[model samples]
Target: MKALQLSAPKQWEQIEIDEPSPPGPGEALVRIHRVGVCGTDLGGYLGKFPFFSYPRIPGHELGVEVVAVGEGVENVKVGDRCSVEPYINCQKCYSCERGLTNCCESHQTLGVMCDGGLTEKMILPARKLHPANNLSYEQSALVETLAIGCHAIDRAHVTEKDTVLVIGSGPIGLSAIEFARVAGARVIVADLSQTRLDFVTEKMGMTDTIQFDGSEADIEKLEAMTDGRRADVVVDATGNHHSMRRAMEMAAFGGRVVYVGITQQDLQFPHAPFLHRRELTILASRNALTGDFARIIQLIESGVIDTDPWITHHAKFEEVIESFPAWTDPESGVVKAVIHIS
Candidate 1:
């Protein structure tokens, strides 16, 4: 088996290894089919994503098939195409006992904390799977990414009547916009690039965009977009500390702000202005639950999720190590890159 491994930051190489053995007692051997390159993966590549370890296979957005099932694996079996949950939690933890395993005290994600599905085969715990009915490899790989947005929306509790402002036009931000739209919030997205804004407008029918770098009246611009009242909910998808700080300044009075982005530096914000005015600020980590994954699959299968515009590029597994680096460069317009393993 050949795996694309990130030995160090800015260094990804393809190394040949023997095919993994059969599944263990509670594990299943997934024949990895599709791997989605997300901002999370890009962050890991650039040495920015937290909780990442080197010499890792950084692909958790998986589209898989059960080539072999473990001894007691009854939920899925051979020939079953599936999407992985990626979240590994300590089932005995207090949070897990309360059915809120997203905050599991001993939780570790596949790509972030352990070997992930960047190779031809991966031995995964059977519990970390959601059945993929008829979805293609590329589409199946997207479920996990979309689920992140779903989980964020769940945390924000976005409603139909709210006016939403989303910062960043990256894949996660776009996914956030989609979920917000489905939740019935009128959304306006801000980004530094017009090309990316055009992508949202032309392909996704989102006409509202704020040019972040071009305008000095950015706060005023966002204020105008929300009819001078500012946004009811503000989400920062740009992991940059500056962008997140700016997002705090852009929220409406008594509005909610969800920080889906993460950075190493401690976040800075004005003290009295942030809290005294009654802003509900939240940090939305990677906490997509099984319910969100199920909902995303339903939305995609039901035609509610238009994934046609989401998938921008695809390459064979053999080309992964070569093409992965290019996807990190924004000028390449790699909105969503998929690696086909089979």
Candidate 2:
């Protein structure tokens, strides 16, 4: 078996590993077909992601095929193509008891807390695989990425009446924009990268956008777009401390602000009085729920959510060591990058 591992910061190594054994009870052996690269992977590559560990096989967004199922496994069978829900949670935790498995106390996301599916095959719980046989391997690989946006929009309770301002036009931010549009909300995207902004407007059909200048003028521009009402729901997906801090300022009175992007640094916002006056709702959205994965798969299969334009780059498993570093550069214009494992 061959696998790509991040041996250290800014270093990638391809090495041979023993093939995985047959699945145990309630488990499934899955051959990885595709791996979607996201900010987490980029963070790990640069040694910035908090949960990432060295010498890790970094792949969580996966499209896989079941090779075999162990005894007592029924959710999936051999030959089924599926999307892997990479969040491995302890069912006995407090969050799990309340059906909030996305934030279980002992949650271990693949590619972060543990070794992941960057290799040819691996074994995982059968329940984590959501079959998407009708969709392409590329579409299946994008489910987990889109589910992040889906879950964030769900957290904000966006609707047609709301005006959503999504900060950052990266993959995560784009995911939120897609769902917000599906909900009939007027979605406006903001990003510092003109290339990304152009990609969203031109390729994604999103006309409303702000080229963030990192000034109060940017808020003024947003106000101009929303008829001075500002955003009814603001989603900050930049994972930058400054962007997260500025998110609250973009929301309307009594509006909701959902932080889907994360940063390990402590953030301090000095507008306590302003926050109280607006009576805003602030939420921290974590990983997606199992239901989100199923919903995204169905959405893609139904053509309600298009995956055609999401992937901007591709590489085979063996080429990742040479190509991965370039994808980390924002100027590369990589909205989403996928590694073909099969």
Candidate 3:
């Protein structure tokens, strides 16, 4: 089987690897159909993702078909098309025991901490696969990316009455905006790129957007959008420390702030007075739960969340080495890039 591996930063090699063994108990052999390239993959390519290691098969967002399933694997069967939950958590961990499997004490995320489904076929725990028979391969592959935002919205408890501000217009940020809208919250998006801001407004039908540059004018615009009260919930998906810090200032009194983006850099916030005065709640959202995957799949199947305009770029498995670098460039205008493996 051929697999794409990141030998090192800025270096990609298509290598031939031995075929994976057949499914064991509680396992399923899946044929990879589509793979979604996300921020983690881009960061791993540039050696920027802290948890990523070199010589890895980098793909987590997957659409796959069940080729075979071991005994007792009733959740999926032969020929079932599914979206994979790539967060491999230890079920015995404290968080997992409490149903917070997204943040297991020791988590091994596919494509980051371990090899993922960027190849022809791979064996996964059957429980990690969520059957999405109604969705296309491209739509099924994007469910994981959407799940990140779905979980973040769940953490913040966003409601119809709340005004939500999503920072960053990247895939993760866009995912947050989608679920926030589904929750019936008034959505406001902020991004440094005018191009991206325009994308959310035009393509995503978001009317309230601000070209943010850490300026007071940006805050003024946000306040104006919220009738001078500021956003009731702020979801920071930029993963930039500056933007994460500014999220504190973007929220209204008694607001909740969810950090969906991860950064290795140490973050420092000096707004103790403001935090205490406003009684703010700070939350760190990690990966998505199985329920999130189920909900997002249903949303896509029901036409509540459109996947038509999300995929802005595409490449075959063989062209990944040549096409990946270009996708990393912001000028390429890639909202979501899917790698076709079959």
Candidate 4:
């Protein structure tokens, strides 16, 4: 089988490798159709993602078709099109036992911790596959990214009366905005890129936008938008540390803040006044649960969520290596790039 392997930092090579065998018990054989490229994959290419190692298959966001099934596989069968939950968890862990499989004590994420779906075919546990019969292959591939937004919104328990501020206009940030709107919250978006902010306002029906100038005036603008009160629910989808720190101060008193982005720096916050006085509820949202996947599929089917403009770039498997660098450049206007594998 042919696969794109990250041989080292800033290096990608398409190479032939041995094909995975038939699915074992409780697993299914799946043929890769679409692979969504995200920051993590780009981080791997730049050797910036934490704990990422080289020679990785470099894909987790997948839309696939089942080719065959092993014994005891029941969730899906041959010919079913599905989206994969690439986060593998140990069912015996305390977190998993509590139905918090996204943060299992021992989590192995595909494409990061192990081999992933950038290849032509692979065997995956049947339970990780979510049926997406009503979705196109590109939309199915987006389920994973969209699921992150669903999980974050689920964590915050957003309500109609709340004012939600999403501090990024990237794919993940856009996902947060989408679900926040579904939750009936008044949505506000902030980003350094005017192009992304315009897209959010024009494409997603978001009217409030904050073009971040890295000044206190930005917060003032947010306060003005909310009638002197900050956002009731703030989601930090920009993994940059400065933005993450700013998110803490952007929430209103007694508001909820969800950190959906990951940063490597040691983040510091004032304890006595800011966080402590506000009585804020801070949450760290990880990968999505199985229910999130099901809900996202339903949202897509019901036409509540649209991913049309979200996908701004596409490439064939053979073209990915050469085309990837341009996607990394902010000027390329890449929102979500999906590679067709078959």
Tens-digit per-residue lDDT, 1-342, candidate 3: 999999999899899999989899999999999999999999999999889998899999999999999989999989999999999999998899999888899999999999999999999999999999999999999999999999999999999999999999999999999999999999999999999998998899999899997889989999877889998999999989888988988999999999999888888786675577888999999889989999999999999999998999999998898899999898889999999999
Residue-level error in angstroms, candidate 1, position 35 = 0.6
Give per-model TM-scores: 0.96, 0.98, 0.99, 0.98
Q: What is the lDDT of residue 134 in candidate 1?
A: 75
RMSD per candidate (Å) reads 1.5, 0.9, 0.8, 0.9
Count of clashes in candidate 1: 0
Q: 14 in model 4: Cα distance from truth in Å?
A: 1.2
Off by over 4 Å in 3: none
Q: Which is the leading candidate under lDDT?
A: 3
Candidate 4 C-alpha lDDT tens digits along 265-330: 878888767689999999999988989898999999999998898898999999998999888888
Model 4: weakest 10-residue lDDT segment is: 265-274
Deviation in angstroms for 3 in model 4?
A: 0.4
In order, what lDDT does every prediction score? 0.85, 0.93, 0.94, 0.91
How much does candidate 3 score in TM-score?
0.99
List runs of model 2 lying over 4 Å from the truth.
none
How well is each residue in 1-342 modelled by candidate 1, as lDDT tens digits?
888888999898888878888888989988898999888788899998888999898889999998888888999878988999998999998889998877789988888888888888988888888888778877889998898788877788899988888898888898899899999989999999888999999989998898897345998888777778888788888888888877767777887888888878888777787655755565565668888887888899999998999999999988877887889888999899998878
Model 2 scores a C-alpha lDDT of: 0.93
- How far out, in Å, is residue 272 in model 4? 2.1
How would you encode candidate 2's per-residue C-alpha lDDT over 86-117 as one tens digit per residue? 99999998899999999999999999989998
